[model samples]
Target: MHELIVSPFLDGYLALRPGHQAGLRLPEHRYRELQAAARTEVPLPTWFAEIAQETWGLDIDGGSARSTLLVREPSDHGFSRASWEINLGCNFACKHCYLGLKEFSGLPWDDKVRLLDIMQAVGVVWFQITGGEPTIDKHFQDAYRYAYSLGMMLTISTNASRLWQKSLLEMFEECPAYRLVVSVYGATEESFDGLTQRRGAWKSFKKGVDAAREAKLPVRLNLIVTEDSADEVDAMVALAERWELDHHVYTNMTPTIYGGPESLLAQSSKHLRERTPFQGCNAGHTFFHADPHGKVSICKVGRDDQIDLMAEGAEGLRKLGGIADKLMLRTGGCQGCQLSGSCLVCRPLAKQFQEAKAPLANYCQHGQQK
Candidate 1:
């Protein structure tokens, strides 16, 4: 069957099969043209009609084809999209890595599948498979296939060092990911290896990108800007452009999700936010994060308030939502703070400081000066 999937973050829609076997990206203007035509009983746009025909072999002008078309919008429930840290293990230990290294085995294959089932049942249509590196998981292929079979749009976040592997590349070729968000640390071998702390990771990363391109897989680059890699930002962007890939630049660094100090050293004072308005976050309302061990929380940063996903199943989601809502509630201190206009602190981070009864000197510039 063919369906129109609308992303809350993007203004357009994608026409995709239930199994995600084939799809077409429809820009906002084109999507609007189709919608307007549908409402006014005008003929479908030539581009969309051609794409639909090519991608799904559906002739929109045909009555039978019209009956088979479906439109799916983002879930109005607590969260429409969710991310899973498939495993916390990694081959490269980047200095700025957020999760930090931990010794722990991930849930069993069956358990991971069960979690995917639960997520699907709860109206989570888009799933982001991430980790220290998701491909490092032994059962990543199995879990990924299971999610794909369940008709979920999957996005894989990786450093791209392992994408050259025959097995991993094959899995991606068979069940294509909705997108591969690859993290590029630097442009040159010296700079890249310096940030990743892996002697030959730069070569592997380049090979992985080449392999993905050779296989015609969709890839997006995320330029991680840190103190060590700042000099290569332009080069990294140039590399992405050379590969004809879309990219985003990230400069903010946070303490490890586990609340460690390692990530603090990697922070760039120039990139730190001096002031941010209190517009609230989408954590509990429309997004959540699941760690490798099945601990579900509202977001990656505020991971302390969590519930066991395997133990509670869907009920765990409810508890998580409640916890997030409660944590987001404004406190007396936040309400009366003089820096409310320019304070970069959010309720969740503020809650972390309150719990520790210590100032988050690394995060808050104004508070630190005070």
Candidate 2:
């Protein structure tokens, strides 16, 4: 038992175990199943089976139960949802950003309608709009207005660079139902500009933050931690306190930039190695991101197109929940993992990649997980 406990695989997992993940211990059998599943052109079936065998010691009855579970079951009345990279456009070029340097061109009127209709049909009570930065798009106000019209909780994920504009400030005031989530890369201008690589972004960001506070809009602040700026955490906390805003500081993961892995290894913090396997991550269950390309994924981190939303619509979107169900059964190296709550496990890895790669590392306590 000590040997098993000492093994790095199960290190953090022993503390807080998930319901489906506890007590199951067929490592060899699960390994074989996972291997077989990996070889298949489409491994969703094998993935489902692997999870069932590990979690319940029971078969999934040929994936039918899993499929039905994903589609028919409405866990929390479809309360939360999100859309990602609507246009691949962002004004700021943050080194730690996953979308990386993509600019947002306004979505065509038809596509915008399709997205709105999807939200209305899905009964998604809460939704987030994100991109390289959703506010950078010229029609960002339109996006907010459309979502607000549906009488749903709306949130925006942005760098807060553009919100300094007076026009944007007025629009935010009109929409009290909306929340603004700003990402602060560091505690000071020098630290922040170093990450964003923009000369005056720090000032613009502060102005935007002030605008949101003055407008009385609900705002959540995100701090992306990197090797360069990690020491500023206490300062960031102080800033959050001073501003009276809810804050989170997350480890940086390589941004999924189209160009290359420029900061993947460089910017990652010492905390990355200390992190234990993820546990209790309910991304798909709590919130999901559907990209403009119609790929339904758990978050921007584990973005994938295997579960195509365009083909299946709301039903397809719900299929992502199946992926989450399967991940709960993944426990061998990950069970009782401590760092589980420290990172965001985007569902696409369990659904498609199956490689146990770290989820969104940039997320701190507030973005998701505890």
Candidate 3:
């Protein structure tokens, strides 16, 4: 039987109401406000019961209820949080993009509206807009306004080229929850333009970053390391400091499951520069991805007939719990790999291991942990 539990914040809200009635205190009233509307009245016990029921969508009893006493579920602010890889169209022909095809094809604006509507219905408060470049979307301005109307906190990842217009930055003045993340491929135009293969993109990106900063907007600097630019990490970090921005940098590997892993490997840095920590992975627990097709998968790389992401919604992540156990228990190529600490585990890597029946070679031989 599946277990059920109440979120701590939801429980706290339930406890705050009168024993006989469920109510929420209004910020202005300074008194309890009844949960009853003209049509429906909710009692404290039943209100808590409904929330628990919604969380797991399962029948819960005293045994499950008692377990809640041992722990408090994380607070549920009731803000729907979602991230979208909006479109595949891009200005740069970057070498590392795992999705090889570059085209303007994307879900129509109407479909996105349906998605936003679904998020609002679920009380999602946060939304992340990602893409080939969100700024380049012809309908982005409209999409942003629609999401803001529904009370969503927005985060966007872009190359930061198209948003260089001061007018564009000004449009965000009323939108406070919006934060822009600009991916800096290189520290200088010489390094950056060479990698992006787009002339003047460096200048355009800097102007956009400066414009956003001038508007008093929060900004983050994101960078991906490739074999060609692996040596530039220090320079990139220094640039981030100069700009007074938060920095995120990671090495790239073509996802093994995706057919384009070869393409990604060609674009990524062959030399390993750093080692990531070895920990039991929490795939479905930490984060998940919903593709344009509306199908969810374990991690972004696990696209298969068995991983039905559409059915799970946010709670579907639970289906993938203890995945590390399955990988560890398997007596296959992944069984005795020395780079276990550095392996990018998932169905893709697992398939690679199974097919080759050998450990996937690490590009940076010298960089391997001894």
**Top of the candidates by TM-score:** 1
Q: Where does model 3 exceed 4 Å of error? A: 1-80, 266-274, 277-287, 305-344, 347-369
**Order of candidates by lDDT, top first?**
1, 2, 3
Ten contiguous residues with the weakest lDDT in model 1: 1-10
| lDDT, each prediction | 0.73, 0.58, 0.55
Report residue 89 deviation for candidate 1 (angstroms).
Answer: 0.7
Weakest 10 consecutive residues of candidate 3 by summed lDDT: 13-22
Q: In model 2, which runs have C-alpha deviations exceeding 4 angstroms?
A: 1-79, 100-106, 252-261, 266-268, 271-273, 281-286, 323-370
Superposing every Cα of model 2 onto the true structure, what RMSD results?
17.2
The positional error of residue 330 in candidate 2, measured at the CA in angstroms, is: 5.5
Q: State every prediction's TM-score relative to the real structure.
A: 0.78, 0.64, 0.66
The residue-by-residue lDDT of candidate 2 on 53-77, one tens digit each, is 6655655435433222211112232
Q: Which wins on lDDT, candidate 1 or candidate 2?
A: 1
lDDT of 1 by residue, 97-181 (tens): 8777844468998899889988876667678999978888889888998887665788999999889999888887777678899
User: Across residues 1-370, which tens digit of lDDT does each residue of candidate 3 receive?
Assistant: 1122111231232222101112222231111222221113222334445654554343433233233221112323232245666676889877666556667766677877766665555444446777777778787777777776654556778888977675567557655435677888887787778777788978988888888777767788887677556778889888889888888887745543445354445344454344334344443344345556455443555444333334444343445434423533435544665655555444444554344333244332223556
Which TM-score value belongs to model 3? 0.66
